[model samples]
Target: MTGGISRVSYSGMLLLGPGTLPLLALLALPLSWVQVGKLNGDVVVQCDTLEPHISWTLNGEQEPMAELVAEGQNLTILGLDLPATGNYSCWAGPVLLDTTYVVVSSTYEEEMDVTCQAESYHGSFHCSWPGPPSAVFRARLTHSDGSVGLWVPVAGGHGQFSVSLADPSFCPFGEELRPLRLHLEGLSDTSYLSLSRHFFLRDIVRPDPPQELTLRWQGEQLHLAWAPPASWQLPKSYFALLYHLQYELPNGTQVERFVEGVEETQVQVGAQRVRISCRDPYTPPAWSPWSPWQDLNAPQ
Candidate 1:
């Protein structure tokens, strides 16, 4: 206000000399910012009525600019240089009007280092990366079938983010090992980084154990039926499943059979005990915890 600009106030109106401006407290002003590439960056702060004269500060010190134009009662930083990058505040004889943070960079950035993996088969995964405070982060899921989606956020904001497939149509499993890709990106003040990782859904496919397992006898033949996992969101047509139905004979013989689809399975169920398990025919993932076994009379 002393060596910088002159100001006068009356009837809620502000008056300032040609080279005088407003000085709005940093917190009071809605953080205004401008990002510039190899060319230049301009930051404009508008205040009430009367024309204002303004100067800028870099970080917190005085920084010179090329042009100070009046497009209203506003101050414009029209400089295309690296030194123009910093926190700028305007002053009209010590009455703060507004503040802005100017970012001057070529906008050429490097890909950030990102890594991700499927921690579970229930369509949830985690991706993490270490980035600077001036960076913006985002996550993506690249399905093996070449489909892309903005991954659903789970927890851990900032540098670490978890994602899940909210849409059931985008099945996480297939007839073949699904190389679901995870992509992490970071856009920084002056640069950017992109990172990606691939995972086989089968490796992490741990479906909830099969449900509603039932075994009964229809005269001489045994009838065994079970429903798909309750947690599976997709319809039967969307993905293929492999069921492992097994039984033990009275003499201690263990026999196993594989079934496709959830259509009630009826087999010559003649054994001392019977149990069931299932997997994705594609990831053919590890067998879910075995289902409870049922004891029944041996086939005559």
Candidate 2:
């Protein structure tokens, strides 16, 4: 009975103290909330100035601006929720200290570009764009002068293209100039590019001159002989040789035929009066003027 009475008196004395009750009530109260800042999206950015009252701008508009209230050296904006298309520039204060460009994601189409190296012959070029798997690609090649050409369709994803050109005259011009045009159609988006200051064609070795020209006698089928031209250069520079032989028939129609690997400069033809023509293998081969019809009737 005495112990219970003592315990109740101690409890009453503890409640009577002014500091104890207030301290306990203070401990029971909830803590104040702390603020945090974060940023999102894949776009990279660099901040110039560090100060209070920092702001953000989307496509150079202040209405969509937001203040960075959090206290930290580095702040990140998470999942940048932007509109269809915009050039996002984040600025701090009135001076527009930091600027950045942002192009909104497109659902319909996208494009990528590549600058080829100098060694690229015939002007190297590359282009890529995101699309559905196994989707076809359509491309159009144009000149800087705004001349449009045919569109070619090719397989999807990154691709390679190359071409060469020559003059119409078929002369030994040594070099030619023209920007090659490769066009593609059947793509998901309508993307076009006019490649300029790029290589369209490259220099290739000149072909060897004609060879193995033969002359013969049509009248007695005798005294067959042949000789090489004096000015013709021997041991041709090119790896291969192209040759041809020509003869005129009785009806005045000319018969001509071409042969490969004809290293020999001269050959013997048949019959009495026959004319033979020879020429170098032009890139697009051409026949030289027919030689004077020889008179095989001369004594051997």
Candidate 3:
């Protein structure tokens, strides 16, 4: 967890230091040695050369060569386990040849409880998932046309990880041709896990609450007015919202009403308090959280 691969080139030999390796192998080396093998399975780390002076070390220490099968340039590890997972460096007469980071494939059940939400249809959204405390997660979005996005590093701790992604091709006014694919990978020092999800943006839309709510008294009736959330898409005719109004009567009775295509309404007075929420009528019927309650008699 605290080791990374730092490469320095001197003369012609490649030098690498022990440090944390990234979930994805991005280090530039003479040969790619990052391998993920099944637990208890056999793994072979081969050097680029077949020199007779070839030697191997595990985690900067002298590996028990006698316990492993070292034939010419090939080092074969049998019954791979957690203790066998680490950086395996090949050496030739004090000169570093190459290093291979070996990891075991996790056998734990896949975690699919990932949640995602978008405030608007602007193509950007955030997703979060629960994972092991020692795991590091990275995510990427696969576009509708089979194009894969870059792997975005997740940020979180205490068994949770989250990342934000966007698709520039998303259009709020156009119908979705295909669902977006999310790919996630969780990596630990000794093991790794992967999960994926497919969903349309409309299913996860959850806009912010309505704004600028006002209540005014006109004779024996109360007039209420509010505006859609600023974060919602523009062109009210194209991106319409449905509002839910609720109030409690002085006698402790609650009344609810739905308003659409309008932002102002009048109701009979004597209501103790009033509140409102809104949602897209065409979507999956998920309403935004209710706005704060406003007392009917508190300063207009």
Best by lDDT: 3
Model 2 segments more than 4 A misplaced: 1-44, 64-77, 80-86, 103-236, 239-300
Per-residue accuracy of model 1 over 1-300 as CA lDDT, tens digit each: 112111211112111112212335323433333323233545454454353565444455554554555554565656445454444566666565555444434323344444443423445554555555445445667765677875443334344444444223344443534567766544333333445676665565655567786666778777777787776546677655688878887679888888887646776655677777777776635666787887756444
Tens digit of per-residue lDDT, candidate 2, span 1-300:
111111000111111111112335325532111111112333334445665556665445665443222223233333433331233344566756544332222233324332222111123334433443322344555542345644444334434332222222222223444544444322111111222233332322222223233443456543333443433434445323354555554555655555554433232333345554444544333344455765444344
- lDDT, ranked from best to worst: 3, 1, 2
Model 3: residue 171 alpha-carbon error in angstroms: 1.4
Give per-residue CA lDDT, model 3, range 1-300, as digits (tens).
112222211111121223334324433443233567777777777777767878888877784532467788888887777788777879998998877767777765364589999888889999988776776677789976668898777887667888999987788889998999998876655666667899999999998899898877777567888999999988988888999999889988889999987888886677788899999899998899999988877335
Q: Which 10-residue window of candidate 1 scores lowest in summed lDDT?
A: 8-17
**lDDT of each model, Cα atoms only?**
0.53, 0.35, 0.75
Sort by TM-score, top down from the best? 3, 1, 2
Which regions in candidate 3 have their CA more than 4 angstroms from the true location? 1-33, 63-67, 107-109, 298-300
Give per-model TM-scores: 0.39, 0.26, 0.81
